[model samples]
Target: MTLVLVRKLLRDVRWGLFAVCLLLFVFSAFWVKIAQRVTTEIAPFFNGVAAVSKINPKLFDEVIFKGPGKVSQAVLGGAEIRFDRPDDFLSVELLHPVVVIVTALWAVSRSSGAVAGEIDRGTMELLLSQPIPRNRLILAHLIVDAVTIPALVLSIVAGTQLGLALIGPFEVDYSVLQKLDLPPMVRLPAGPPVLEVHAARQWYAVVNLAALVFALSGTTMLVSALGRNRWRAVAAAGLIVIGMFVANVIGQLWDSAAFVRPVTVFYYYQPQKIWLKENWTVDLGEAWAGGSPMVEIPVMPVLIGVGAIGYLLALRVFDRRDLPAPL
Candidate 1:
């Protein structure tokens, strides 16, 4: 019976699942081409410098991308963020707020219908007439959520990888290396880093994305459990996502509102940092250097805690609430 219920939930969200995958497919198809074109154009600029100098391509890339006012640096210099870097590229692509909200909206749609939707359709009364306990019904929804959300997120990643494969492997232009003017003092990289593949470097994104969607699902489930109808549940969830997202953006860009970070779920959801395998702190000494000091935080605990709490709270509310009175 539990398995059947799970299948039913899967059927309910099948179109949503398809829509997510389709969107990712379309985005990746275009993203890969754009990345390649940018790389090709930049390769020549560096190659011109390499021709006259013995500087390595890697060192030159670092200077231009990590240099002052380069890819992500400000006028005086700050974060040496390079979007061209494989790790940053993939991490930013799918972990964007747009992706999060779309996934959340889908979760809300499915979750909102968990009870209120059934009520609207006049199915709740019939389902409750059976021997299934209220907890089992809720558990079935939770169980299905666990199975579905991650699959949806993974589809985006898979589509990205597939799209990249069609374009070509990412590499520095050898021609740029030929004609590049570089400083003699620039030391050659000992060898390729232990992890060179973008996929390898960004593996943490999978875990982070899964946790993120689950966090959204937790809130979504709670709202659905409490709502009088599916539409109301969706509205409630949409507002929560929007409010939290706005708080997240303000906290990110405005030091004055930094306090909001701890309160918003998006604060802990740092896919880019996680993919890079390190986080940055403002470089106290480099006040003029425009670089952030690196720091590390435990990733799993906070997200897991938030998700667990929301689900538990929802379960308590759901179990205690009266069933939908027949229309």
Candidate 2:
């Protein structure tokens, strides 16, 4: 029965799923190209900054990079973004508003519709009339999520690889490197200033994205199970996502608001740290302790915890709650 329901759900969402996957693939690839273009175009400006940094490092610190740098940090996942580095620049593409919003919308749409949508469409009574248990219905949605979320995230990675293949390795300005005053031990490239955007660096980021969508799915599923109207559930879930995203951004920019970081789900979605610092996990105790300016919070565990708790709560609620008559 669960298998049948899963198949039905898959069939129902097949076209929508395909369209979203295709959109993400094309958008991600285009974003990579765009990042590459922007990096190349801004090379001179960055080089000039580097050259001037040698003259008056405090000029940028007190003037340009101080006030405006926080804005960049907030947007790019709270790090000093280096446009020249392929990993840094490419990570920005992943953190783009379009990518996050598209994936979140997908999660909200599917999960909010899982229970409440059935109720709204007058299908809940019919579905419940069958021998199938209520939990099995939710399980079917979970199975579908298990299958689809990875496909959606992998599409981003595949698109990125395709873009890298088409655009070839990124070219760095040697002058920027020289002017930045590297330590005496570090060797500059003797040949053309070319750096490959390694796709492997993004593997964890892909995992992070999957966890993000999964958490969102479970959250909206919980909301759906509690509600009778799909649109209302969707609106609630959408607002929740937007609120957390805003809170995360605010925490990055404002120190007083940093208290919100430990609570927001977006706080765990740190692709930039994964790419640049090779930081994969954080101690929950440390995250709560909150000493560092930017501590890498636990990504996989918190996301999975949120998803698991939401799923369990939704299952429990759906099992006990009385269903309203089909509208």
Candidate 3:
């Protein structure tokens, strides 16, 4: 019977679901196109560099081909050290603002309605009249939301892959250059290593992205359960999401407000940074940690923990709260 209600709720929220998914998919496609355009604009420079390397002779032994150098630095304005990795490229595309914000809002809307919307619409009284328990009903709503968040995340991933494929191969063959044999350096093979797209890394970033959205969804649901009405619920959840994002972004500019970052969810949910810099520390012992000391912590688990805590609290809140009388 709970499952029936869950299915019915799913049907009820179809419009919101469609709108959220469509917006995310479009943003994903749009951003990928922009990235591709940037790549195209810069591809000629790399080609010219490759040509020059042929005459330079010593360029063949250079490690530039294996890393994220000129293209990332010149085209994307990204740091070469970070963007040089395969996963960093995918992380840059998949972890866009549109995907994260929209997915979180979707969770906010669905969660806000769990108990508050029904009460405000004067339907809560009747819902409690059914044999279905309040906790089950709320859980069902969250379950539906949980399913949708991942779908939205995937849309972004697909858009990134599509963009990469559309642009064709973006590699620069360094083999055309003459080998430089400098003593011990001669041990290194004089081959033109290539730099190109890796599809697998995109999925890895997406996996972390999914965790991020899931955490935001659950946190919003918790706020929803706390509010007395749907509007209040939405506001509370929206403010937190916006606040955390703002704090994270601004923290980059100011050192004083840096303390606010750790408490905010954004501090712990950077797949791009982890994959790009190759550091996975979660203790955050020092502010932001700046990808050092190698804490070896998994971000997904912390995000999941936050989500679980939020849902449990929401369940308790809804179970104890009194439903409003129907008009």
lDDT of 1 by residue, 273-325 (tens): 65675542222222222324433345566677777777887788978988768
lDDT computed for candidate 1: 0.64
Local error of candidate 1 at residue 240 (angstroms): 0.8
Local distance difference test, per candidate?
0.64, 0.81, 0.63
* Clashing residue pairs in candidate 2 (N, C-alpha, C atoms within 3 angstroms): none
Ten-residue region with minimum lDDT total, candidate 1: 280-289
Please give, for residues 1-327, the per-residue lDDT of candidate 3 as tens digits: 778888888898888877876776667666655544434334333444544444442253234533444332322313332332333445665445556666667767777787778777877777778898878877787678677767777776766666666755545333322243335533322223344555655555666667777777678777777766889888888888888877865554455665576777777776665655544545554345553443445677888778888888888987887655666
Across residues 276-313, which tens digit of lDDT does each residue of candidate 2 receive?
A: 77787754443445554445456788999899889999
For model 2, give the 10-residue run with minimal summed lDDT: 56-65
lDDT of 3: 0.63
